[model samples]
Target: MTDTAQYQHFNVFLAHEDHKSEPYHKYLKASANYETYELKSSLEVDGILYVKVPKTSQPTWAKFAKSLTNSSIDELQNNSSSAVLIIRAPKATMAVTFGYGRHLLDMECFVTDFGIKTALNTLNHDTLRSVDVITLDEQGVQKKSQASRSSNVGVFGIDISKDLLRGVTGSSKAGVGLFNISGSGTTFSFGKKIKVKDMPALVERIYSYYQSNDYKDSFAWVDNIRRLEEKKDIEPLNKKLIDEISKTNPNIVISIPEMLDWDTITGFSFTRTKRNIKPTIDSSDYYSSLDKDNLSIDSLKRDRLFVFDSSDEDPEYKLYDCLYFEIKGSEKTYILFSGTWYEIADSFVETINKLLAEIDITSLEFPEVYTWQETSGKGKVVEKIETEGDYNERAALEKNYYVLDKKLVKSSRTTTSIELCDLLTKDQQFIHVKHRKGGSAGLSHLFAQGNVAAEIMLGDRKFRVAARSVIRNKVSKDIVETVPLEKLDSTKVEIVFLILGENSSTLKGNLPFFSKVNLTKAYENLRQKGFKVTIGGVDKVVKPMP
Candidate 1:
């Protein structure tokens, strides 16, 4: 080291391998105001920028203080600076940067995730001050957070844990980025910030930072989770989705992602502007939105589909916005739902899909039924009032089906009554049905309810007695006497999740990712109890709103 060398903090940015030899102008953003510096060193270019902009607005506290009888407020102006020091090396161009210098450069001029890779390679994880973590699942369930508290290091925010290691800040022999944040942000840096007296030292730091980036992962703990994709990884996964779906027989399909009001959404169209369009219950019809010729992601974004009002006009629930598509990557599975991207553990998605496939889904058969808002009821006029459960219960009774939709079986143990199933068929099928959407979060409760009911049906004999008695007491159908009681055979009982849809294919695609995980657990638990479990995507009979 030079005797005149001084310590300084600087972030490092590595140019994309392809653009290593590009001119400095190509590296900077267009019309960037920067002054050149003459170092007379082996550096290609040394540029610095000082920005002086007026504050957008005064602080609220400043205004309130000035409102006092006597107060003085000299608003401070904003003064910030950034520097870009670049050196052309063999096969690559490395830049020693500080502050928001990159704001003055082409956003994509540098390599992607180079900072994080370098930090993981260079820094010591054990003594690191903080780490950022994020989690995303195929269900569109997502969470991103940062923690200053290590089990050993103090954590800053409460309830913060690592899901994806985005940034790390702490002391390192190779130095750290500004404020110690690395990898997950715009810049990868080395050395602490300070006045630089020696030009040679800063130039050397650039090469060392590059070396730190090229070095293989040596931090055992940090490298352990590198196999997982960062939550912020979007474009690459999106391209992967496009590629995977382009393949023949891709196990992916367009789904409704959330529980939408099917009653209002008579059908869907890809083109937002269409007249007298036929309403289809399925979401896959996004292609058939009257402009079926061009079905691509670009089209989905450009010609966002809209759900129409009952008269096929004056509605703007963007269909494109609600659509969800799932794809499995090499290591993780990703989903694009409600216009956001999320990734799930490939193992979780695959396991759930496999388990879901095991439970045969029979086509649900029912009249065109829906949640109706009766406009001419007893008192004030309501729009649509009959709930899905009410429809199911009434339909089951009319057909002489053993109706148990709301008949609660009191649990002698917990003083709680559990609904055995929505409707029980004479053929020994105990059906549990839900009119639900949104995502896994919404369906989780339904799955939990079904699982608990299934367990109680098989193990709790007292509950079974109460279940049959409730039907016999509340139901007018004589078939209530035939309801299984006194002696129960688990093998003979069939537990079905009746979904009001055209077929199982819809459920397979539309069901949320985490809901499928819960379904898998429920299926296994029920299967172990010697019962046949299935998902029924039944046909719903539609009647014009009464």
Candidate 2:
């Protein structure tokens, strides 16, 4: 017998109903290099375990494979340091077992009818030698297959399926350039410009990425769970009712649909209008007059204001009749509600109270409110401010210094004044600044903000006029008081996204490359919108002061 020490070592486990088919035993016995043993009851093995299934139907083999993936197999893997399972079955049976084993067990296992057939074929050819023996090592075996004259390319050793290769390459023609089968091994090239010497490193990187489980496993049991979830019946929202109500004017007082009528229900309608309002008149009175005029609400316009009304009719208990919500500049105020002017206020009064029943008052906490000294005298009283903090200040500063070069003047101090774009330049540049501090910041928010800002600026005439007035006021100090009217038009507005702290280590964390990839995709989308867009990170904008 050949010296067993020279060849790869494996512990064999034969799982058969009866001793009818024992070709695997004969084959293993003939190979003097392998130390074969029968697995009695315990799965604990010192070496590799070859589970030989009887020559049966595919379904039966699959059931057997699944049954073996219980606690016993797990215990075997936990106890044995170099435990491996080689499932030898029929072609169809092997495929089923291979998939199941990979999904359920972490142990290094493989299924093959070809490996057994090749081992049996070795008896005839005296010169035949085992090129690569499957081992218990985490890294799987690699084999090299010849490339055929046909477009189909075979890569041995690497378990990349043909479908996976096709999906990655996109086309069969491109597949040839990416993968080339050679005598030594299957060489993989990343791109057309990649050097031949760097192919091995690239292949190793790909292998490492896959092995690390950075991407979702195709053979994972989670896939089946996800597929089952996808098959579940999920009811969609009623779009017909939403579409009908969305287009209807809140002032028109259209009757509610019988199907939608419910107790204590509220409905909201949003509409954008180019209707001009004088700053001197009360906003509530102006909005109320629009309702009386029976003006048709156009949902397609920009700078949309939402109107909400509840079904409650009892006047004594009603909190509001109809809430006309308007967000002007940065301030959020309910300008009109049930023919009453809504002003944000605070009233503090000392109260003497007795508990009717035992209450959990310890859990309650008082809300914080901003207050300042009204007068400098001894009898000075504290006055509360409705709002606090300038959230748009940082974005405004970023836009002014980076994009416009501090050319434009400061617009209105309100939040909605320059919420979208801080500066409207002489060259028709609309600059949107986004500052992020943490790694979990999503690029989608930045994209949406910039896109919506551009959309409103271009589509809404009243908003454009207000924007022009702000820009005109700024430019009047530097240039002539009468700036060209054509400059205010949205015809040649170029959007610039000034991103601050984008490359900060705190903002990008471990997956730094993914941020760049996401940004590139966002850039492409903005460009597709017919806007001349430019993205500049903090590094590109900030330079050493000379």
Candidate 3:
């Protein structure tokens, strides 16, 4: 095809759901550069085809891509030098399929969650921007950006990004194999290749750690795998697991119920069995009611180690009615529960196993546990009341700074949920101020509240309008001149969890592990929704008032 004709005859095919196809068409139509084609039973001509698939329909999309290779469709032919396939999905399977299909069809593919924006930007050289974009080279290897040309290093055929590889190796050029790249120019290889299916999760896990400023542990994890070949030490294993668990939010504690060898196990009593199968009983309602009855015990059990709702508070319903256990070992005291296996302390496996062996037979019995009472007055309702300390911190920030406000008032006709977040700016900065005399556990509540407010700001449009209205009413004259509502979308919202305290030493040392992980996860979650997120202490903000 002639150069001029190639440009003239460029065709775009859109494969998307009926609801999502309009935007793709609209953007393509606005480009005014290429001819668009619709998917048909039979085809006649070939050009650059753009495929937009939702994350839920990735499997079907993959199958469709595979079908194109074997089909006898004459229109599927590419007149240009290369055909383009864009797969927009969050699932790793779609990415793998895109990579595989690129090789099979001799087409260049771009994989992203940003969808048609990235595709249109690349094809038309439009000024539109996207967060992250991945493209496959001629060899079917994934590239983070178009600038990444080298393909020497890859895990399980999926090319590793330079940032990820550099974070692991701390260098541009590094050998690929089963090995640990260390600081002192040391390499230890495990001699086993990671499976292709497992590479996505592994890469994401490592890259998240690398991104979270936990590079030391990321490197140690790779090194520990090699160490497994030489020796079976529990220390490295414990460290490796603990590091993995730390990245997750809300903390996970895993435990196995202790039972004596001689004790006879019995099924639930008739009353208990009736409660379980009752048509009127919602499991959550029953559990929550139980929590109210056990409020005293729950308060007594609440320590600096971990927080548990007497009932299952986790959105996923993974956490249930399980008592917490503090497993103290040489390294760290890990809190254990029955629901999640993520945050179990290091040395727990060895120590717990030993403890289980020494359990007395006489102590074995069906333990007395609190059940939900319908008429219980003492409910476990820990209302988050804003304190004087919170007001003081807000005053300090507002008095010291010009660009922010203390209270982000969300106005309604009847009522407004007083957002714990104190400082908000017209530039879309959302700051939550927390002043606690206790340990990092208090900071968790702050983080949780901050995250919730951030979510509301990002998702709830009613709140957004109300917030803008409140800003105009409250701060337009006194706090600031006026509040602009233009830059207040998800992309513009920036969440800051600011913890104020006198004990800087303790906060600094424990904050990174205790608060940083949850905050980082929150940051990531918000970032995925196009909002910016950050976590820090009083030092990053203003000085703590004496």
Best prediction by TM-score: 1
Q: Report the C-alpha lDDT of model 2 over 116-197, residue by residue, as the tens digit.
A: 2212211121212222222111111233232232222222232221011111111212222322111101111122334323
In candidate 1 the C-alpha lDDT for residue 40 amounts to 40
In model 2, the clashing pairs are 11-48, 142-157, 143-157, 329-415, 329-416, 329-417, 330-415, 330-416
The residue ranges of model 2 lying beyond 4 angstroms of the native Cα positions read 1-104, 107-428, 440-444, 452-491, 502-511, 537-546
Instruction: State the lDDT of candidate 3 residue by residue for 391-493, as single tens digits.
Output: 4444445544222334544534225475626665545556665543222334445666677766665556576666666665554444332233444457655
Model 3 earns a TM-score of: 0.29
What is the full ranking by TM-score, best candidate first?
A: 1, 3, 2
Q: Is candidate 1 or candidate 2 better by TM-score?
A: 1
Residue 381, candidate 3: alpha-carbon lDDT: 26
TM of each candidate vs. truth: 0.58, 0.25, 0.29
Candidate 2 vs candidate 3: which has greater TM-score? 3
Worst window of 10 by summed lDDT in candidate 1: 153-162
RMSD of each: 8.6, 26.7, 21.7
Select the stronger candidate by TM-score from 1 and 3: 1
If both were scored by lDDT, which would come out higher, candidate 1 or candidate 3? 1
Candidates, ranked, lDDT: 1, 3, 2
lDDT of 3: 0.33
The candidate, 1 or 2, that scores higher on lDDT is 1
